[model samples]
Target: MKVSVQGVRGSIPTSGSQTTQFGGNTSCVTLMEDGRMIILDGGSGLQKVTLPDPEVKRVDILLTHFHLDHIQGLGFFSPLFDPDKEIHIWGPSSITHNLHSRLNRFLSPPLFPVLMRDLPCEIVLHDVSNSSFEIGPFTITSQFVIHPGATVGFRIKGKSAVFAYVPDHEPALGPKGLIFDKKWISGFELMEEADLLLHDGQFTTEQYGKKIGWGHSSMEDAIQLAEYVGVKRLLLTHHDPAHSDTKLNEILDALKSKHTGQLDFDLAREGMEIELG
Candidate 1:
């Protein structure tokens, strides 16, 4: 399996010399091989990614949520303009509305001149639950997480390995944190021994103390979760925009020193690539 980090930043994008190395796009990742492509999110990073497979005429975008940062790139995705491409979007439906209405709430009207109907591609939307689904060689499963609305995490089991995306989460994974029903948090068990787990590590230990219900995780929290879940590799992503490259490096170094063994990790940078057998 081949995974590429098209964008890694969180909240808003960043720039300037201090932020150059880590990149500034929100959240987009792609898995590609031969004649197929699977996109994880459409954050600003998605706008910059050129699909690895030129022969990919069919695309499936597995969205974790519909937060602006997560869906912003959908409007600019070049393939949406291609009338011949078959694009299917799968995501959690809000309690008040289905997937299409929820997306159109942001994607249409005065907010944007073009509507989903205006798009030339054969677009389809699937509102998903905590169930397993399939797209080509990938068996996709989703779970609910503690966020404001219907936030979810995804696990994609490909032929060679399992890759899970936890772009936003607020579980208390440490000793002092409050315990919630295991079933309420969908992606934990699905991530067990995962080949690669790209999870939300958007706050520092200190910052997490004050932002408990904000629906993001600290590096320490993530490390503990990764260790407990037996993940082989953890890529800490969904970086906070205010964190400069230097600050992120400091956090990365600290995390590496504090956690070691079967579970390994690195900060996810835009354009980084990993291969799983």
Candidate 2:
């Protein structure tokens, strides 16, 4: 499987010299295998994704939640305007609303100039919770996780590799920290023993303390979870918009020094690509 990081920032997009290194777009990633494309999230970075082959008319997008930072790029995604494309979007649903109507709330007049119904593409919306399904060459598992609202984490398995994505998680919300029991830990099933894990590490320990329950993880929390899950490689993503490149570098340097030789880890940067098997 081939994975591409289009955006890494969390909460909101940022700009300027300080943010250029890591990029400023909110959460979006792409996984491609067997000429099939699976998009995760529809953040501002979604506008950057392009269909490499015009002949590949089908595309799937899996959204973790309806947060603004996660779905802000849907209106700008070019595929929505392409009549020849078949777009399938999967997301969690609330008791009062389904995925289509919820997404329409954002794609409607006041929030967006073009309504979702006005899009030219053949769009299909699927409501997902704890479920397993297939798309092209991939088997995907979606499970509810600890976050604000109906958020989910995904485990995607291709022919030769497994990739886990949980960019807006807060698994260590309780005073006890990450629960040691795998059965009780949020998103553990999605992350366990994956070849690569892209996870939330949006705050520092101190910052996390002040923003508890804001539905993000500290770098320490992310590292601990990755270590516990036994993932081969870990890429901490969903960078805080306020954290400049210099600040992120400093944090990475310190983490490397503190946890050297324990695990393979790095910050996920926009435009970064990884091939796994």
Candidate 3:
């Protein structure tokens, strides 16, 4: 199996010498298993990828939520309009509307020239119910996350390895203004012992405090969760738009020093690929 990081920036895309290394596009990733593809999130990063040819067959896209940065690439994804191709989308249901309707809102005329109903490819939307299900050779499971609108973290277990993706989650803060115990621990459990975990690390401890309940995690919080889960490798994702590559390196250096040999962690970079046995 192979996992590729197409984009990692959070909120919006940024451009500057400072962000050149890790990249400036929003969240999007591609996971390939047994000749099939599974796409996670659809941020600006999706625009960076070249979709497979129409004759190649359909793929699955599992979404965390419908935040603007997370779905901005939906209309730009080339394969969606191919007559011979199909795209299956799975995501948490919204309180006020179904997933299909929400997606339609984005693709309708005025918002975009092409309406979702007019797309040539078949688009199937499924409202995930927080349970485990099988998709080809992968076993997938999801859990609710603490975001403004409901969000979910996904764990995909293939024949030989496990991969977890959790973006835009706030490590629960208690009434006293500290990390909530249960929510923090539960997030770790969702990533426990995975071969690779791609997680949100969108703020510093100070910034996270100011944005409590805004649904994002700090670098320190991500490291602690990595330790708690005992994951072999943790890739810090959903980088803040204002963070320069140099600043990110500084944060990583501090994490490396603090965690030492307890956990393996690194910042997620666009174009990076990891292969599992």
Candidate models: Cα lDDT each: 0.83, 0.94, 0.83
Please give the TM-score that candidate 3 achieves against the real structure.
0.93
- lDDT for each residue of candidate 2 in 1-277, tens digit (9 for 90 to 100): 9999999999898878999999999999999998788999999999999987877788899999999999999999998999999999999978888888899999998999998998999999999999999998999999999999999999999999999999999999988888888987899889999999999999999999999999999998899999999999999999999999999999999988888557899999999999988
Predicted model with the maximum lDDT: 2
TM-score of 2: 0.98
10 residues in a row with least lDDT, candidate 1: 178-187
Which stretches in model 3 have alpha-carbon errors above 4 Å? 51-54, 176-184
Residues 81-175, candidate 1, lDDT per residue (tens digit)? Answer: 88988889999877789998888877798777789888899888988878799888888888877676788888888888999888888777445
Question: Which residues of candidate 2, in runs, are more than 4 Å off?
Answer: none
lDDT of 1 at 29: 94
Per-model TM-score, in order, reads 0.93, 0.98, 0.93
Better of 2 and 3 by TM-score: 2
